[model samples]
Target: MSERKHIKVTYSTLASPDPLLHEYFDESVVEAKAGFGKTFPMYINGEERTASQTFEKRSPVDLDLVMGYFQKGTAEDVNDAVATAKAAFLAWSGRPWQERVAIMRKAADLISERLFHMGAVMSLEIGKNRLEALGDVEETADLIRYNCDAIEQNDNFSRPLLSESDKHHNRSVLKPYGVWAVISPFNFPGALAGGPAGAALVAGNCVVLKPATDTPYTAWLLTECFRDAGVPAGVFNFVTGGGRSVGQTLVDHPDVAGVTFTGSYDVGMHILRTFAQGRYPRPVIAEMGGKNPTIISKKADIDKAAMGVMRSAFGLQGQKCSACSRVYVHNDVKDEFMTKLVDLTSQINVGDPTVKDNWMGPVANMGAYEDYKEFVADLHANGDVVFGGKILEELGNGYFVAPTIVDNLPLDHRLWKQEMFLPIVTVTGYEDMDKAMKMANDVEYGLTAGFFSEDDDEVQWWLDNIEAGVLYVNRSSGATTGAWPGYQSFGGWKGSGSTGKAAGSFYYVQQYMKEQSQTIVG
Candidate 1:
């Protein structure tokens, strides 16, 4: 019971020497059949707290309890965490700009060191593949380093104007919003948490972060990275709990100046309403869900287009908000493309993520798996399943949904309109460009959209007309570059984003800080 399960860190060609990439194991993984179950301590106010109740953590791939932790957070715990963040904010906000830069660079280095380890943990805990997990970690570290450099490079030092009789000179600097908090979701847990944590820390604000209940380990490891980087003990904090209490506590805390969140649209709206009615309403940046669309042009390359659509619709089991849910193919190429798409999708291997060749893994949990099953069933009852529309029954233990493609579904079909976060892809053929554009813009949720075309004019037209925040041309919707942390200045228009961007552009950070200009006569 007192033994730690350790795994050596494996690095890809992209890994750096920072210890932040080191793998962590259960120093003492104990399983219980009944009673209070097992538990892992919570990180609060720079110390680990062992409470009375246990919070069980499970692996998505298998219904096994990977690790469990104590639900040590109470109202008092919240206050302590917030107060520590507030106390640290005083000195952090007043520190020299260069000092902040150095600290942030150190943090980035630490994260780089632990990139591979963090990636593996994310893969094991959340069921993301090795490549996807590594990509998230690499992008996170790069984003932090980039932001640190940008802030220093910008060096917004105001210069005094020349005058015959000058009364005063002034220098303006960006200041912190004191105590900030981040409540992140399970999908992209490490990247989501790291984006806000690194950004807020570099901006000289103290943070208390609450990771998703299902994926808090990534956040805990990230907290270790901050600690290893020599971030002030009270500067960064982590806590895990149910959404209702922990989320509301973070949002409504008087000492908490700002909140960065990413989750569903409904919950995001609830937070907005709650904050509006509260005494201390701070800035909240939330990246909600989306029903993204993908467009295929008549003259597009059929093979490439089909492959792109397949990956976008099936990769990561389509849990991503940016996943291509709706695909609009030109009528001229619809028949050929659909056939090829079905063939390509049918060939995808749906199994465990550990398998090097397994193209698709199981859904995150039983609820998600059930939802996907119900969605496919509904689609089958209402329309037709062109290629794959059923779950692999032989695949036991894990929540495995077959890579499915549905055709002949009307625009008003539930499958077409819904954000089916599963391996379900719906196709609609368009005769004209105008009609295609209308179909793509039909949905209320606009997070991302993809387009495949050789014509420059058509690409530009879709780019100009698409309602999504992020649009792609001649590429699958899954192509997210390292430069984009998915939370930066870009956020969806309608239901996807609130209060500007999430990170890497200072919009959310800028919201926390107050701005004022001074004028004087000499």
Candidate 2:
């Protein structure tokens, strides 16, 4: 592919991609499939290590396709990884900030160079379609580059402070914590795993990345980019195993100075509380899931409202933390919006995500597949299943389900408040804008929200009243989804995120460090 023809793909800007992108991705997918079912090892102290036992990872797109075999790491492995990181922290952190930034930038460029293969592995491993998978990889590279840029622009977060006299020099310097554990979820494995790991590393902290068991292969590919970029030994490591053994051990390790986790609310809370119960509190940057919502006003464009809501609600099968799960359309245009949404939902082609034509693939695993079924059953029992509610058994043995929309659900229903995290959405009609805003902010999560209003007053009202960290108005690409690095700061509020700061923003990289006041008296 020519460099000139390369489209800089992002979450929101994936329309009309050049045909060469598909040609290269298709070639990479075939090459990736040729080397399936290989056993992969964990990385510790810049070397590959293996456990006595291993686990099989199969694609959600097809259970018959064994993606790879990954080591089932143990508590001992976590201890080893943490100790290695701690041993390497001083040297890594002591290096000049410019050197660290250069290494991270090279790593980001390496990720971009290997984008096709990485995107292919992600799609087959986690069932994301071509564009979404490629976008995730591209975002990973951009996220790393963004953090590096933030550090450089801030001058390594070292600033001169007011001095009492000329003889006395005073300055404020931000320094790295010791060891950081990055726990990433399966959805968007490349971006979530590599993004945090990159930030922590660029901030001078050694990283111990523990990816979700379902997508270790994708994480492994990411680790190679860092290693190939000449990151020092023991500065970056990767471990894979069950959460009970490997994950808990990493979090509980006393040598660990901090953590960055992205997953469910219960697990994030557990990590936060666990990190606090130590001798002293440590930093835990956690982003839990969100039950995001989108509101449509009577004055809104019906086409934009329907398209945005459908894309956000069903993208990635609603597995994203920012997926729009709830909708409150004005009673005047509720029927019209639903008609368009259902028609758009019906046209979505669900099959093998690796195929070029398929728009969506499958849920990450059997647990999510079962959860989707239970959620659909409950929606059918309590609400009107207007769009779809069937399991796509004809689409091979993969865990494929139709995009579902339910209307007329009671406002008091628990599902309306709960985070389903599936390709299912609940819609309700509201007569008053104030009541709709109240319903939107009633949920505990404040991660992301969308509003459709052509009126300037209503737009300003929505912006002022919406409680989410990320908000969108009149977007046709996606309602609550499509946050790109440097374009939108992706984080949450309330039960959604532990920290008030968002990723890909100016303030994110500094979270990995602590400020120290420096003084020299003559």
Candidate 3:
């Protein structure tokens, strides 16, 4: 796979993937599955160290299949890692910006070279389809590259701040925050872990990344890329364990500077509140999941909206924070839209993500499987199940479920307003466009919103009035899905995120550092 060397490419809007991707991913998947289960150690102070206890990571595709065993990192491990990062901070932070950019660019290139292998690991680890898995890896590299580009294009963000006079020259420079703890989500492990770490590291901060417990291997590979690029030891660290033991410890650690988290609202808020309690507030950048919505107007193309909505609602099993979960359609076109939606959703093939033919795959683990059952039960009790309300028992022991869609539920129902993060969506019809838009924004979570309207007036109104960080209109690929890094810097509003700034954009890297004013008077 490395010999083939997948050349890096950009994805502005959603487009069909390369045909050769299947051929490459399938062979790598076979080789990856055949290899012996790995044993990963905590990377601390530039060395790989093991803990007394370890935890198993089993494949969601098959319950008995052990993907690997990772060290169960403890508070001591977090402390050691942070101390190492803090110790190395002055040298790493003081390193020339040009050299840092060079190393990061090399890491990005290395990520692109190992795309197929990394994608294979992501497939088994996270249960994303082959195309999606490959795309995730690619996005990771692209995000790093984008940040590197931003650093170079902006002259390392060291511009003059309106020089007062020749004698008193004033300027500003972005400085590292010492040690930035990166807590990434499981849905997009490679990209989320590397994306934030890249931003932090390129901006001259040491990074201690804590990947989601379930997706350690993918993050491990991403770390390998950076390590291979010769990032100084103690500058980058990776630790794996339960959130309570490893994660909370990192959050509460004294020397640690700031945090970048991507997960549920409850946990993100907890981190924010914790960081806010001290004498001086520390920076906390978080992207919590959302109960994202879509509005289909009467003048919209029903076929286009149905196809786009199905892809967004079921892709990655609807696990993305930006995935479309609740959709409101105009009453005049409701019946026709429902028919097309059910047909499109039914056509999705669910099975092992490693398989090229499968479009949808299992939920991440047993917890998500149980959550799916509970969420579907709540939906059935509260609404009319027009399609897909059962689990697929024949699809091995994997946590597989049908792509479910229901209608006629109260727009304000807890299930409708809350973020389920499952392959289930609720639909309702509205007579007025204003009411539909209102229903879309009723939820406290405002991360992503989609609008399907041919009319320019309605599109403009939706774009102007919708309270979301990322907005889509008449998108055939996905209504609320598909936020590329350079294309769209994905972020949230209201309860969805602590930071209003989006990732994979200019402002994101700036968050990893604090600004300092420099003045010289002769």
Per-residue lDDT of model 2, residues 325-433, tens digit only: 9999999999899999999998999999989889889988999988888888888898999988888999998999999999988889999989988899999999999
Regions of model 3 farther than 4 Å from truth: 5-15
lDDT per residue (tens digit) for residues 233-286 in model 3 = 999999999888899999988788999999999999998988777567789999
**Predicted candidate 2: what Cα RMSD to the true structure?**
1.2
- Name the better of 1 and 2 by lDDT: 2
Backbone atom clashes (below 3 Å) for every candidate? 12, 0, 0
What does the lDDT read for residue 489 in candidate 2? 96
> Model 2 off-target regions past 4 Å?
1-6
Clashes counted in candidate 2 amount to: 0
Best by TM-score: 2
Q: Rank the candidates by TM-score, best first.
A: 2, 3, 1
Candidate 1 structure quality by residue, lDDT tens digits, 1-522: 333232222212222323322222111111111212345666766787755565666676666545445474666667788988888787887887688778878877777666556766676667776556766766667667766765676573223444445665443545677888888888778768887787788877898888888787777778888877878878888777777777788777777877788888888888877766657557777788778887888979888788778877877788777778888898999999999999888898877664455667788877888898788888888777887777776776777778888888767876676777777888888888888888778776877788888988988888899987776666632421122643434567788888545455544445545544444665
* Candidate 2 colliding pairs: none
lDDT of 3: 0.88
